[model samples]
Target: SDQISKDESMVGFVDDLQFFIDNRDGETVVGLKQKLEICGRGAAFNDAKKKKELFAKLLMRFERFSSAQQLFAYIMAAIHETFDTKIIPSTSSLSTQEIDAMIEAEIVDKIMAEIGEGSDHMTLNRTHIKGMIYWLADKCYVRWHCD
Candidate 1:
């Protein structure tokens, strides 16, 4: 059952990636590329070889599109999976940094809510919550703030 669930998730991810690749514009692709590069650099000291492999796969997949659409899709999917939010705010009104921060906050809020719900009287420590937020942020390539 777990394997089946994992397979289904992979299929969904691929479908989302294809949709993004087909629909994304140059600006979105550039932004995703920048984020992916940042993620790659951040991982170098901890797991250089794995990070290199992952980045190589990402770059190769990115080459299939005009730009980094796959990476964008992956990041968006990660955010949605973490926060249960599918809305990516339009860049027309908000700057990229603002949008990123908004998404990060939403993710953190969702995580905190889940942790609270799963605990007795929300007894989980601040450090644990912060750790989970940071882990999710790293996985999604988002900038997280405890504030």
Candidate 2:
């Protein structure tokens, strides 16, 4: 994804990510897992192996960025929030485009800010955000339909 903006505060992005990874306590890890489980099952992809492969590719892309962990967390939180406050309550499935729009509305600005602060040259765009969302859906971190 192309960068939306840049900022000087991003100088220490690498350090911040290292610190985040190094200091990941059990609570934090559990919270991530819980977020993933909140929506029960995902129906985006029916083939488990294919989903795993796609997730692996996305993980590779995520690792190349300085604020990988934070970006992942933000998207996960946004997905969970979207499902909890929107999709699940509606008790109906949303088209992928609709889900993408909702998720993007919630995170794009925040993510742009974080991305600016997370790297000097690396950037993220809607495509990358959607990729992350799709991977999460495939992994059962969020759902498009109520279960």
TM for every model, in the order presented, reads 0.28, 0.47
- Candidate 1 lDDT over 1-147, as tens digits, reads 232223322222446555533433333323333443543433333443344345445434434342233433544455545443332324345564765566556654555454453322113333333333233334443332111
RMSD of each: 11.7, 8.1
Of candidate 2, the 10-residue stretch with the lowest lDDT total is 3-12
* Candidate 2 lDDT tens digits, 1-147: 333232222333354334423332332223222433444433433443354455446545556454454555655567556656876555456655665566566655556655664344444555565555555544445444554
- The TM-score, computed over Cα atoms with residue i paired to residue i, of candidate 1 is 0.28
Q: lDDT, candidate 1, residue 12?
A: 28
Give the Å error, residue 32, model 1: 6.4
Say what the RMSD of model 2 is. 8.1
Candidate 2 runs further than 4 Å off:
1-58, 61-66, 91-100, 107-110, 113-118
Q: Provide the lowest-lDDT 10-residue window in model 1.
A: 3-12
Task: Tell me the whole-model lDDT of each prediction, alpha carbons only.
Answer: 0.39, 0.49
